[model samples]
Target: MTEHQALRIRRFSTDSAPVGERFDAWAAHSTYCDMVTTYRSDLPFDAHRDNVSIGPLILAGRTWRHPDPSLAYDAKRTPARIRADQRDFHSFSLQICGTAALRSDASTAVKRAGDLYLLDFARPFERVITPGSEISLSVPRDWLPADTGKLHGASLTRGVGSLFGDYLMSLYNTLPQLTRHDVPHIVRATTELLKASLHPELDTLAAAQTPIRDLLLQRIRRYIDDHLLQPDLTPGSICRDVGLSRAMLYRLFESAGGVMREIRQKRLYRVHQVLSSPDRPEERIRDVAWRHGFTDEKYFYRIFKAEFGHTPRETVEQVRHRRETGTN
Candidate 1:
């Protein structure tokens, strides 16, 4: 409710505590607050703040930012009752960042750009990560498919083909999970993809399909269409806004062919739409094309004819004749 409201619950608080120098605990809970908390993990079990966010899912992440830090944090601890406690949630992690040593229930893995580690939140996890490294979680009991629930007992390693994995990693590296206005929808869409990616049968994943992907593609395209006049709507800007890699970004048009091809096609489509509109006859075709990111008038005509099989002049003439006869 409050702007930038922070709710922090801490097992170790140096601010009001008598001792702040070093904290040593076998295990403890964290103080959660803010859109994200960036933190440190060390023996005597230390904690730091995180800039990463937890949207809809119960996400807790840690990364090293300072020197003199070879950090390790245990999300689940070895308890006295048994080897591990029963975890109800499914957890996943991505080294969506720098380097690190990662440990799952089965073995230790190194962190890389595409490295993914899956685990059971019901069981304990120990991690030794480096600065700029990333950690993420997906609550499968609460998020994943029913049949894929079998994955919770197994250890998660990288190289799995799932959009949930990609989407989770994508959010970590690209989009800010929190926004002044858009956090809700961002969290919703992200979790949808995240849950879908966990299914053994990727077919169950709604995000990987043609329709939803196409829907998002259309949203992005329409956004581009509305903002074509902006000079800075280049690939980098589009990647940032659309939360896609420059390479994967081109795939948005793979459904049609290629990105630039789609851009030109859409531009031509808009140009024709304007030129053919009988009510907008006063608007110049050159003005319409330029408004859609066409810089050269002559080049626009060439591409238009190549695409539409007619020149801009001819298209306008056809529109004029159609308007005169009410047959357009």
Candidate 2:
């Protein structure tokens, strides 16, 4: 990875502190130290956290070790604390080793190993955390859909939930090798997985299963863009090449106003780009349209006008004028 894409990892541990002062040091280093009150057991407190910031999301791998397994720590976010802090964010924690009981006004559940649960920081909540390791993801409230409020304190361990939990673990494991170019795609996939796993009623879930559906959609779009200049780039060809059934292809692009419509729009965009380029001044608009798989000149002109609010000739003229005047 380039220097700019290099992963920035921050490690916080109580290992350097004296045994008597370890718990306080751990609390001081916590990300939510001010938002919650932490109570530790009498046993020696030992904790370690590694954090990586990926765009707007923060992914952390945390471990708490104590001599007593029954009670590691109790952290509570009270109403007064919430009001005083005014923090609004969502936390998705995947328990990797042990169990924890989470409670909030929206829901209450115990999350065991391999289980994932969500916490909304805007709401008051309590967590009786046992000695364990977990992968935690912190997402800004605005980054999630409004309906995600229902997921607060909800334990997810089945079906799509399991898939999401596994994805998080995999992402955490591979974070060290990822580049900056991968950040946007990771964020998009994470959002899609979260939406699919947390909200089943969403229309986007009808296309396919989470992560698989997300990957397929990306592949389809890339394939379409790569072959936009081909004349026989129809849904049948896409289905054949992308290994998707015709029904599944249609379902995948349903939210995009159907596959054929997407093709037409993409062609129109290509034609518009050609028309608006000063270097392509000698190329006729019809030839540009045909090159982009728009065979019917009249139909192309109509749709082009409808899409851009101007005729193809107008776009060329505007480009010519801007080139001559040396102005954008």
Best by TM-score: 2
**Candidate 2 lDDT for residue 2:** 67
Q: What is the lDDT of candidate 2?
A: 0.79
* lDDT per residue as tens, model 2, 1-328: 4633657888888888898888778767754633244554666677899999888999999898766667646677877778877878898999998778777775567888888988888887887778889999988989878978777887777777877787687678766656676677778788777777776565746532555566567667777897989988999878766665688788988998998998889878887887887787597777888888888999988988999999999998898899999999
Q: After superposition, how far is residue 149 of candidate 2 from its true place, in Å?
A: 0.9
| Candidate 1 local lDDT, 1-328, one digit each (tens) | 7533432222233333323333322123232111112244442223343333445455545543445545433333334212334446665766656665545557666656656656555554454445464656656475666655455434344333445556665555433323333444455665555545555355545454544465456556755776666767776777777677788777666767776676677767877888877778487777888788888999998988988899999988997898789884
RMSD of each: 7.9, 11.8
List lDDT for all candidates, in order: 0.56, 0.79
* Candidate 2: pairs in clash: none
Model 1 CA deviation exceeding 4 Å by range: 1-61, 71-87, 97-114, 128-130, 142-158, 161-165, 174-212, 215-219, 232-237, 240-243, 268-288, 302-328
TM-score between candidate 2 and the true structure: 0.59
The prediction achieving the highest lDDT against the true structure is: 2
